[model samples]
Target: MAAGLAVTLATMTMGACSGERSEFDTRNESFLNDASPDAPAPGPGCGHQCSLDGRSVINTCTGETVQTCAADLACGAGVCQPPCAAAAADKSSNGCDFYFQEPRFEYTTISQSCYAAYVVNTSMQPVEVSMELEGKPLDLSRALYRAEPGSAEMTPLVGPIPPGESAILFISDKSPDTPLTPLESAYLGCPEGVVPASYVGGTPWGTGYGVAFHLTTNAPVSLAAVFPFGGASSAYSSATLLLPVPTWAKQHMIVNAWEMFRDGFGPGAQIFAAEDDTEVTIVPSRPIQSGKGVTGAPARVPVTYHLDKGQLLQIAQNEELTGSLVSSTKPTAIVGGHACANVPTHVTTCDVLAQQIPALEQWGHEYVGVGYAPRMGGEDELMMYRIIAARDGTRLDYDPALPAGAPVTMSAGEHVSFPAGVGEAFVVRTQDADHPIYLAAYMPGHGAAGGIWTGSDGRGDPDFVNVVPAGQYMSSYSFYADPTFADTSLVLVRAKTNGEFKDVSLECAGTLTDWKPVGTRGDYEFTRVILSRNYRPGDSFDGGGTCQYGLQRTKSDGPFTATIWGTAYCVSYGYTGGMALRKLVEIPLDVPH
Candidate 1:
């Protein structure tokens, strides 16, 4: 998950559910504390020791150690208690203690026709989990399989899963052995046209697209969706995405576009409306290079569409949609990337790259744009960043500042892009929150001297990714590498002067190299974690490799941002390379006491 960013509150109602309820409360409520004015103040001679464990704080003062309440509880005047249970008899001297609820999970891509869903139990206790299809719960006992992390096999999940394990679920045309019961079909609005096996050249979910689902568990879990592409005989170009939490959704969004991997081919946008009866408006900031209705000219028109709960809209276009704006009456989820993109126009191979876009409201004013390792032969990689404004008159301030003539003013729905120096990291910020803006980074291909460079006439397609905002920076995150990628690298960022790196930890299913500070932008510092089959403890290559697969988890003492970069060779050789940034599922913040 990216870190927690401040959000404006807008009250909305959700229907209740039957059966076992989730242990977590989805409601956003505030807590109040009553502190006595006569409370004694600490004396100069009084020494204090304080530390945080999860959401709880441990403080040693006046020769005694006391643990404060969990994050959701209220601690005031040195007394800790659940905000609503201050007067309850269960209250104890240590505070009204309780377990923190598991965070809610929100997935943007779910289709029985093309993909499979996996959930990892990230907590210490066993948990029973269930699925909700389009807001309706399914039989918790049906269609569930469990597997250990990194395992290739799955068995029926007949009972609660133990800690540190995971499970898989599917959605598709029901089979005789895994038939969709009439009740389940009704809830999913199934029996639609089955996706043909030849769809997307026989990819896993090619012809049989199914309904999206929401998973609920008794404990926090990590969610992911995997799409195997490049035909059934060859699942070469596969893509994996980390599911986001619904609470992170906002009403506004902007996605950058690039030339299709091939000249005639274009990129596709998979948009999912997270809420019911949602009205979504998609405005094209630029014209479509190629598509059914597209002429040779650009299409600068806006299109509005409606979605029933759980419905998905897939749009493919040849021209770039960089400045496009997506606004919904309610929160929505979006996954945008090319089906396959050729980096340098001359290269014959291409890879799939897609990521869940965070809502615009989650966008922050400050950001540090970082790049992946330089291409082989020390060839400089070009980095381009786009700043999208959420409101009119938003002003941008840059460090290593923009070239003298770059524009600084951005109007709502408008976006501006500037080139970042080769192998350089830079910081950009807005004047205040009133002018929140989203930032995106792009790496251009074309004789770039890397794993997979393709282009024609010196023109190549660029890889675009949403840069994590400083406000959304988190202290911890868990992400997986595309099993199909030959090489992968994890980029980490933090305040340049912060020595919290000593508190940082990185664990991978495979080997993980030590952290190396790669660059700095203003007061922000950056580092890279190399993960590859050929990486050795003392290796100093430019972060490249093969078969870089597995889950990677990271944690640090202070707020920081991280993203994964993966690349492969030409498509003819069965390699398609691209990168996807991960967004964090936040732990709810404790109210101020």
Candidate 2:
């Protein structure tokens, strides 16, 4: 299975490099030395090392010379390069071509009268960013600068951020004297003749409500939406790292469940329709906490609703909605998160958690399950994962090294999960290529009964994260850091026999260790490197201070997947979660025969 996919990827690599020079003369000596003798040589019918296109050097399967570089690059020095050093000076003209044009944030709520969003320039150059509110250009002045983490004061953003740096944009509600129009009121879900509760005087930002924003930047950048509660000292916050609109979005999704009943906080799914007049149908596997229900049999019951462009619907309920399926007439973006949850019931505090749900079309057959560290002063915790099948007859194969009892087969729309001991990771793959599945890892939400919470705490309120599949993996990626989190770590997974890390850079944080294997799952190995500010004291969150915010970049010689895990704790409330490093959206290297 791996061999077939590798060859297809090579063909794709060739297609991308098809426009280079047509002749492979000795002056390009680097090409000959780079070509592996074991790689397929040109077939008997071919006479030269370069394909007829003159771009590529040689084909791995047929041994024929082929173009493997993009048009703007030159096949030289054993790799794609610019014709001149000056031509390659700009990062955007090289391999950094993919970008998100319209990145959307779903839950921008006002806390203490102000809300904030962050933009990190992932490119090597400066970027000009603009904001859009309800389809209109928002005045840049409305956005004030919130200080980066570990800083003492706030300032306005008046210039382009240097490469690899970040800027915060704050939005505050307008005064009540400027009443909202009926149209504006409707958009905010406010009843007629009344101002939205969020905008009313003395209303706290944590009114169980939020607004949406659409951000546009001239260069590729990662975004984070943050809401803070309480005052300084016991300042608690909830944050969600946002994903830019990919080149393609799907119309179907299998919604993952948020752990229910952690301090009475329930799980919810927020669906955003990006297109106008989209008809959405939602089938719930369990009843919702909002007192909404369908009349038909449970398996056949579905609630249908229509959404205009940029509108969103959120469903929070008491029951687990793990198996719920959402479908729309057009493409849409969805997010799953807990409104406020404790890792375990009876814990000291609970906070918000959210992750953007990848579309079903992006789901793959294989995944490596991993989780966050146990709560402070607590023993290792058990991690749980849910596997959902997208098609009929999905047969699963787990790493035999894992503890027994993981399910081996699943039917269409079927979902199941099992627990693994702390720090233990495993791989799961479908037996065939036709049936794909989605996997989600749940971190232990509850802490030891006597430790954090006074009451009994077993599994804790597990924060759910969508595990990225190997098929959706990328050789390069960039992600934003949760500046407010006290601690953060980078998790890396690669095929044990096939890939190796290359050029891993943690912008502002220092690497605690080199790449080291944490576990083996079949042919894949999980490795991790701790990333924290230079001042982090040991592994404890208490001494890490506020995490410094910046963009992180990681690349590998072969395909690999990764995500960042973060934890924030205060005397009053605490939370933990993770998000995928955004893979540059480009033409997939895998080509189906």
Model 1's alpha-carbon lDDT is 0.43
Using lDDT as the measure, which candidate wins? 2
lDDT of 2 by residue, 1-593 (tens): 00000000000111211122232110100111111211233345433232212235554345554557565443332234442321122111112112111111112321232344556665445666666545666666535353554443456667776655666655433354675544232111211222211332221122122234556665555565544321122233344445554322544453635455432355666666666787777676665433223122244367676766655655655455655667777767776656454444333344445556666655666677765544443333555566787666676655434344466657766677655654666666665445667886655443432332333322223345567766555444555444444445566665442233344333333322344444342445555544443324223233342234344555544445666654443311112112222222222212111
Model 1 per-residue lDDT tens digits across residues 338-427: 544444333433434454555655556667777765534242445456667767766665555453333466776676655544456666
What TM-score do all the candidates reach, one by one? 0.61, 0.64
- C-alpha RMSD by candidate, in order: 14.2, 13.1
Error of 2 at 446 (Å): 5.7
